[model samples]
Target chain A: MLGLNNRDTRFFLIVIALTLFTPFLLQPFPEGSAMAQFNAGYPDLMQRFAIYGIFAIGFNILLGLTGYLSFGHAAFLGVGSYSAVWMFKLLSLNVIPGIILAVIVSGIFALIIGYISLRRSGIYFSILTLAFAQMSFNLAYSVLTPITNGETGLQIRLNDPRILDGEGASQYTNLFGLDMSSSFKLAMGDYVFTFNAGYYFCAIIAIAAFYLSLRIFRSPFGLMLRAVKSNQHRMNYTGLNTRPYTLAAFVISGMYAGLAGGLLAAMDPLAGAERMQWTASGEVVLMTILGGTGTLMGPILGAGFIKYFENIFSKINDNILHAWFSALPDGLEGFLVTIIHPFVGKGWHLTLGLVFMLVVIFLPGGLVEGGQRIKTMFSRKKNSDAASDVKPAE
Target chain B: MDAILLQTLNGLDKGAAYALIALGLTLIFGTLGVVNFAHGALFMIGSFCAVTLQRLLSISYTTIDPEKTDFLGNPAKIETPYIEGWFGPEIGAAIIDWSVPLAIIFAIPIMVTLGFIMERGLIKHFYNRPHADQILVTFGLAIVLQEIIKYYFGANPIPTPAPTAFKGSLDIGVMIGFDPNAIIYPIWRLIYFVFSLIVIGGIFAFLRFTTFGMVVRAGMADRETVGLLGINIDKRFTIMFGIAAAVAGLAGVMYTPINSPNYEFGMEFLVLSFVVVVVGGMGSLPGAVMAGFLLGILGSFASMNEVKQIFPGIDQIIIYLVAIIILLVRPRGLMGRKGVMEE
Candidate 1:
């Protein structure tokens, strides 16, 4: 709401509809098409899309709203994931309890870390968080080996006694008669579209999160957060304690990461220490900046874009390039494939670098601003014509 | 006492590297105010330079030797370098034999040009951006650089051996009269420590004595004021970047023999070096150099058996534990200046 106007709401709805329905529409792409790859229908990837989207959204609340650049958010996510997995192992595998545990644990962690880290603002805050996150990562990797399972990653073993199942030792049953692994598919004229049930479940959760964010954006609490972002010292002089507000934002965002991590473990019951790594934390920052920080939809769009490209681009190989380029001249095709070969698979990272660089350089406001500029350009032409036509009527 | 002495010796070699890399990082941050996430990548590239030199020297074509027999009673296969065809056998063989030592000359120019390109091409565009943006872009650049290295060299670590003359360990225990092998240390590591000290001393002396270094130091203190005095601060900053790059590169080259060169090696050093830089005070060169060795020795001690007995897993988090304590007690770090971040 800070950035969005009335028209933007309509555009956002359209984009969301497109994002949701595209999978169903692209079902019949003869197994492989550019459109088919966009099927946000796969359970694994769609779960990730929602999980990472939630993580980015939470990140944006602090970074975008409060202007504090945290470099260690992944520690909370990792902590949340570990907490949730432990809940599954120790208590019930029902996701709700697991998620609640994750949020509570991660919030406590953020409370401690934020209390100290938020003492300094700007770059110092960033470095402090980074240092603390590194501490968490190291601890998780080594000292907490029994809890985190060290480098091999923490997973749900068959030996994990499902106490909720009453000594039956079976996997936890899904609540509400909703199958987590089930997929909904539609077919029409060689086009088959499939959507995972977990996706819809995740989608519903995302919408709820988005609505909460919207409410936050509109509330007096959000205003205080913005004021803190603009000028903390001034807010302090105005008799409003900035500490509580900043800490609140930190805890809220930490819970959001916790929820995401919990969902990730639910959809796939494995949590690795690598999830808590500084690089993983840095990734959400990149996603937020690249999408359009501070906007409700920006982080979601950024998450989808990054994940899609990461998956699809890494899948591309020499054969794929050769298939497309073979339609050209014999010599030219070979040359083109070789040129494109290095930028795919492991080389996909190069593309990510270029995208990040371009986004930072030319689109500082991110894709949200880029979209706004395009809309303004189109609307200006219509507005000018309407003004000239209205002059005759006047 | 012997164990303590050995650990101290172990730390000096590591401390020397930490100082060298942190010096470069602090130099760039001091002059440009940009937190370079790619400094580690430059260190990585420097190590690869050694790898390349080893590859270049070892390039040979195989040929069947009709007169000589193999262990299996077959004709022996002899290998000859391509250089032998162009140059005379004597010079070619000598050059091939001595390529690892010759990599220093090759690495200098390559590393310098890479520094110039990095500063001019990517970092130049981010000068006006926020620190976060600079961090992100440079980080992206670091990933790209590391990925390229991985693509070329594969994921495995490549051992870059030192010259044959410096292959064995030096027995410092015999001289000190504690058991003959108690203070045994690698010859290359000793050489590296000495080399680092000379380079560090030379850099310090240059800054202390030279007019160029004086102007650079002046620029670091205040760029606008130096610019007002009709000096080209941008040029000095660029040269400082080059110097920083060369320092990291040389550190990396010397380090190749200690730990094998791998794509992810820089990331490990990068994290520790950042801690060193923060502990040393963000823009203080002397602080960086001092803290590098301090942290290195402290970390080494934390990993020792005696330290482990006191704190079960202290080694895993010793650097960060120290960083947190320092930030809490002295937020501006040990020798940090006023107006620096004080938590």
Candidate 2:
């Protein structure tokens, strides 16, 4: 059971099964079907699902467990990416060294930022993190142009001194000659499934990240983090220093974000300063909150839900809307299209904003809490049915 | 000396804007004890009011004129704005030219009503929630507002120019014993600075002199005691929210000519204004005003070639750097009262 309790073992196994079979599960629709547009089994999108899942999972460790909402996580992610791209340029096209360097560089970056930002709690802490992130972003865009490549971003060139990668070797990212872009397409009857090496690589790392997070969650350290969130003042009164604990949590989460960033560069060997923008940081926060912060499966679920919606909803346009509602009466169809127009296509952000607001207002615990409520409702109904049967016997 | 004076003037105009926005933010925070993320959206909507009025005035109808012929030999058509028809053409043209100033009248009621609804429908419910939740909800609202504006305005910065009279620059170097043309400043920028001063002055006098302001200040100090005095403090706080919204709206209205109002302008200013509020002390009015001008002047000075040569890119992050240093050194900010948001 990998040191997990019975229920946790089952939950972990289920998650593993889901991630392993994602290529099959996501492609519910067959090839050439109208609904195929909604299928998200492609390599690029699937990799994003796993990568951002890791990002949100890491973010939840700090914000969910310790209740320190750092608004500067994207800076660490950006640093990781830049380090990864640099490794590709200098050392090798192989992803191992690049990813390792990414995690290390981002960890140090997070440590410096976290140390300074954690000085104040609550809104002040949020603002401090925001300030640091904005500063890093500005520096990356201007002063640190030599390192970050400025606005054009850092990319691998043809004639770089990649010492570890032999002369005339493939410039693409790879693992021991296996290209990340290489895929095996299985066409069975009307359905086609793609098994991508890059996706599998990202998937394996995501699973490992999840398992590590699970261990951290069950550990006494996690319990201490929860205590910090619940009552840091009381923890201070108990003569115990909580700074190290929160700082550790922050650094670990920063490492997780770095790992995600590394995987992103591995999948596509390019890094941009836009990755460090505050909006990117806000996206991860949105994913964590939407999925159910502090829950084991919540961040992953939230990441998938958001990525899926972002892809599918943005693909919808007026033409598609008209086609979907063609059977309805003209006036009614026009009304529906007009009403729904603003929530799709380039207007996806509006829908996201509305959903986020509603989630914060009503479903504070997010989708997981909603699921729990439904389960309890059904169980209550079953109990009532049994009581009615007993009354009839009496 | 002229260079210094010119930069100071430039800083004063920028500071005026920052002070106005921060003052409203501080007022709401002090009175309601709620951290509003959507305050920037209110500022944005105010700028749009000017755009909206300009658009409304420019609506035109075409009339066929038999007296003139088109290039195609068809009847010539003349397009005339409804305002031009209602008033004389000269007067209507003047009105359209002065739309930015006129937007002040148009934006006040609209911004105040929007603020009232935001407080009653959304913010009122979040009063007892955690600060994190309040931040999230308000942030969401800000996004929604921005998107709505983008949907209408098509994501372009609309130009709302000042009146023709104030379009030119004024040279003050001659009068101040400097060489001719040594210091030339925009007339509208000067107007904006004076206007902000009046607004800031009015807010202070209101707080210092009025009974309503007294109760609100007392409520900020101790809400429970004020409520215990059988006063409907909630009503007054809501009114305070309206006034704050009006102040922010007026700032946005006047700022239209300075930086052609765009949907994203509110968010751009929001971050800087938050820094200003924090540096000024979260709930202090004078502190907000002082910090606004001080940071604005410092910002301009940092961008100077001599300073940039010594330390490059200082102007880009001077405010944030100052905020971080001050927050660490003076945790309560410049003039922050004790025990407010300490937890």
Give the top-scoring candidate (lDDT).
2
| Candidate 2 lDDT, B194-312, residue by residue in tens | 99999999988998899988998899888999999999999999999999999999999999999998888888788889899999998988899999999989999888999888998
Interface RMSD of each: 1.8, 0.8
DockQ of each: 0.61, 0.80
| Tens-digit per-residue lDDT, A1-394, candidate 1 | 4355666456546656755664553243445565454444556776678888989889988988898999899999999989888877877666777788988999999999999988877667887898889888988888889999999888877677656645543374233345566677665566655677677766777766775676677578988899988888899898878998999999889889988888887777789999988889988988898899888778987887788778777888777687777789999999988888878876887788778778877888788778876766676787966433331100
Point out the worst 10-residue segment of candidate 2 chain A by lDDT. Answer: A385-394
Runs in model 2 deviating more than 4 A are: A384-394, B66-76
Q: Per-residue lDDT for B63-114 in model 1, tens only?
A: 9989999999899998888888668787887676566557778888888888
Model 1 CA deviation exceeding 4 Å by range: A1-22, A25-40, A167-173, A384-394, B69-76, B83-98, B341-343
Task: Place model 2 in a CAPRI quality band.
Answer: high
lDDT of 2 by residue, A207-326 (tens): 999999999998999999999999999999999999999999999999999999998999999999999988788888889888888887889988998999999889999998998899
